[model samples]
Target chain A: MKQLKIIKIGGGIIDDAASLAQFLHLFAQVDGPKILVHGGGKGASEMLRALGIAPQLVNGRRITDAATLDTVTMFYAGKTNKAIVAGLQQNRVNALGLSGADGNVIRAVKRPVREIDYGFVGDLTPAGVDAALLGALLGLGLTPVICAITHDGQGQLLNTNADTIAATVAVALSEKFVVELHYCFEKNGVLLDVNDDNSVIEKINLTSYAELKEAGIIADGMIPKLDNSFDALSQGVSKVIIGHALKINDSLKTVLCLN
Target chain B: MKQLKIIKIGGGIIDDAASLAQFLHLFAQVDGPKILVHGGGKGASEMLRALGIAPQLVNGRRITDAATLDTVTMFYAGKTNKAIVAGLQQNRVNALGLSGADGNVIRAVKRPVREIDYGFVGDLTPAGVDAALLGALLGLGLTPVICAITHDGQGQLLNTNADTIAATVAVALSEKFVVELHYCFEKNGVLLDVNDDNSVIEKINLTSYAELKEAGIIADGMIPKLDNSFDALSQGVSKVIIGHALKINDSLKTVLCLN
Candidate 1:
C-alpha cells in the first residue's frame, strides 16, 4: 500500500500567519500523498467579539449557536482554508480546499442534546468518510486542505473537531494506504515532563500510554488527543505522531502505535 | 459534444435566504452537467460594516484591501459557497464548491496599479482556466459551485468578477462541452421596456444588441454583462441565457447567440 500522511494543525500554529506559513512551507517539504485538516483558531472568537456575538457556553463548554456556526464556517472553511490552499499552491502543491459539504466527504450527525445543546456541532464516525473520493483526489495529485466544518447531508453545516476528522479520515483510508496521522501543535512533542518542551517521550505504545495516564503526565488536554490517536491506531491507522507544527521534518517527535 | 450549463447568480437572489433556497432547488432540477458561479452579495458588505471596515471605493469601483479581501474570502468561499453546496446536496445534487485557488482552476494576475490601484483584485482571461480538470470534475458527476475568488499562484487570493469567471470558464470548457452560460438575477430577462417586467426580449442576436445599446435600453450594468456574454459566445460558448433565478426551468428568458 502506498504511504499517506494525514496532518492536523490546531490553534497554536494557525493563530499566527508567519508560523502558519512556516509550517506550510515545512509541510510542503514532507513528500508523499498528504491531506491537511485544520482547526478553527482564535480568529473565530475574535471575529465573534468584533461582530458582538457574546460567547455562549454551558458549564464551561462552548456552544455553537447558529450565528457562531456561520462565523466559524466562514473562518475555517473560507479564509483560513483558502489561505492555506494558496500558500500550498505557492509551494508548488496543487492544494484543493474543502468543507465536508463540498463533496459530501464527511457526513456527520448533529450532536444530540444531552445535558447541554451543542447547537450545530457535529459528531462523526469513520464510516461517514468518503474514502474512495479522497483516494481519487489523491490519485489526481491534488492535495486536499480540509476545514473543520462538516455537513449532516441534509443542508446543515456543523462545527467539528479537527483532530477527530483527521483520525476518522485516516482510519477510513487505512484500507487503501499505510495511514500515518500527525497532530501538530506548539510543543516539540508529547512531553515526559509537562513543563519541558524538550522532554519528548520519543515513542509510546498502549502500555506506555496507560502508564503515562496513570503517572498524570498525559492528563487534561493531552488526554483526549492521545485517546483519539490510540483509537485511530487500534482501527488500522499505522501510526500517530504528535509534534511541533514548524518542526514536522525534524526527528524529535512522539510516535504512538498499538505495539 | 456533451451539453453543459454554467449558471451565475448575483445579489438579487443571494441576499434573501428563502429566494436563494428557491433558486438552488431550481438549479438542481436543471438537467445535464452544470456549474454554478456566485457573486458576493450584500452579506459581505454587511459583515464588513459590522466589523467596522469602512467601504473604500475609488472612482465608483470597490478597492479590495487586505482586510476587505479577508472578509470577502470568508463570506464568498466559506459561508455563501458552502451554504449553496449543502443546499444543493439536500436536493440530491452532488455539488463541489471551489475557489479559483482550488485545483488552481483559475490562476489570475493581480490588477496592475495604474491610474487607480485595485488592491488584491485579479484580472483573468479564458486561457488561464484549467478546462481539463473542470471537465474531469464534471465527468465525475459533480456540480462545481465556484466563488468569485482567484489566486495569483503566489499565495495571494484576489477578488474576481463572478460574471467574468462564469463567462471565462464557459469559454474554456467549450472545447470539451457544449457550454450554455446562464446569468440569473432579478428580472425575467433583458427588458424591451425598462418599466415593464413582461417586456422581455426573448432572443438577442449581436445586431439587435447593438441596436438595443443605441436605443439606451441596454445601458449601465447590463452593458458589461451582455458584453461578457457575447465575448463568450464568439469564443466558443454555444449560447448565453439571461433570466430570473426562479424561472430557470421556464422558457421566459433571453437567449443570446452570435447568428
Candidate 2:
C-alpha cells in the first residue's frame, strides 16, 4: 500500500501567522501524498466580538446558534482556508481547500437536540467521508486542505470538530493506504511531566497506554484525544503521532501503536 | 464539440433568499456540463457596517483596501460560495466551490496602480483559467461553483470581478467545448425601451448590436457589459445570453452572436 500522512493542526499554530507560515513551509517538505486538516483559530471569536455578538454558551458548552455558525463559516471556510491555500500555492504545492459542502466530501448529520440545543453542530462517522472523491483529487496531484465546516446533504452547514474530522477521514482512507495520523499541537509530545516540556515519552503501545491511564498520567483532555488515537489504530490506521506543529518533521515526538 | 454553459449571477438575485433559492433550482436543471459563478451580495456591506469599516471610494471607483479585501473574501469565497454550493447539493447537483487559488485554477495578477491603488484586487486573462483541470472535474461529474476571489499565484488573495471571470472561463473552455455564456440579473433582457420590460430583443447579432448602439438604445453602464460579451463571442464563445436569474429556463432572453 502507498503511504499517506494526514496531519491535523489546531489553533495554537494557526492563530499565529508566523507559526502557521513556518508550519506550512515544513509541511510542504513532507515527501508523500498527504492531506492537511486545520482547526479554527481564535480569529472567529475575535471577529464575533467585533461584530457585537456575545458568546452564547448553554450549560458551559458553547452553542452554535445561527449567527455563530455564520461567523465561524466565514472565518474557517473563508479567511483561514484561503490563506493556507494561497500560501501553499506560493510554496509550489498544489493545495485545494475544501469545506464539506464542496463536492459533498463529508456529508455530516446535524447533531440531534437532546438536553441542550447545539443549533448547527455536526456529528460524523467514517461512512460520511467520500473516499473516492478524495482519492481522485489526490490522483490529480492536488493536496487537499480541509477546514472544520461540514454540511448536511439537505443544505445546512454545521460546525464540527477538526480532530474528529481528521480521525474519521484517516479511518475512511486507511483501507486504501497505510495511513499515519499526526496530531500537531502546542506541546512537544505526551510529556511524562506536564510542566516539564522536555520530558517527552518516546513511544506508547496499548499496554503502556492502559498503564498511563491507570497511573493517572493520562487524564482529562488528553484521555479523550489518546483514546481516539488508539481507536483509529485498531481500525486499520498504521500509526498515530503527537507532537508540536513546528516540530512535525523532527523525530522527538510520541508515537502510538496497537502492539 | 460538447456543449457547456457558464452562468454568472450577480447581487440582484443573490441578496434575496427566496430568489437565490429559485435561481439555484432552475440552474440545477440546466442540461449537460455547467458552471456557476456568483458575485458578492449586500450581506458583505452590511457586515462591514456592523464591523465599523467605511467604504473607500476614489474617483467613483470603490477601492479594495486591506480590510475591505478581507471582508469581501470572507463574504464571496466563504459564506456566499458555500451557501450556493450547499443549495445546489440539496438540488441534487454535485457542486464544488472554488476560489482561483484552489488547484491554481485561475492565477490572477494584482491590478497595477496608476492614480489610485486598488489594494488586493486581481486582474485576469484567458491564460490564467485552468481549462484542463476544470474539464477533468466535469469529467468526474462535478459542477464547479466559483466565487469572485482569486489569488496572485503568490500568498495574496485578491478581489476580482465575477463577470470578467465568467467570460474568461468561457473563452478558455471554448477550445474543448461549445461554450455558452449566460449573464443572469434582474432585467428580462436587452430592452428596446429601458422602462419597458416587455420590449425584449430576442436575438442580437453583430450588425444589430452596431445599429442598436448607433440609435442610442444600448448606452451607459450596459455599453461595457455588452462590449465584453461581444469580445468573448469574438474570442470563441459560441453564445452569450442575458436574462433574469429566476427566468433562466424561460424563452424571454437576449442572445448575442458574432454573425
Go through the candidates in order and give each one's C-alpha lDDT.
Answer: 0.93, 0.93
A70-188: candidate 1 lDDT, tens digit per residue: 99999999989999999999999999998888888999999999877999999999999989989988988889999999999999999998888999999999999999999998899
lDDT of 2 by residue, A1-259 (tens): 8899999999888999999999999999988999999988889989989988887877644589889999999999999999999999999999999998898999999999998788899999989999899989998899999999999989899999999999999999998889999999999999998999999998999999999999988788899899999999999999999999999999989999999
Off by over 4 Å in 2: A58-61
Off by over 4 Å in 1: A58-60
Fnat of each candidate = 0.90, 0.77
Worst 10 residues of 1 chain B by lDDT: B54-63
Give every collision pair in model 2: none
Residue B204's lDDT in candidate 1: 94
User: Each predicted complex: what DockQ?
Assistant: 0.91, 0.86
- Residue-by-residue lDDT tens digits, candidate 2, B140-184: 899999999999987999889899999999999999999999999
Best model number under DockQ: 1
For residue A26, what is the lDDT in candidate 1? 95
lDDT of 2 at B148: 96
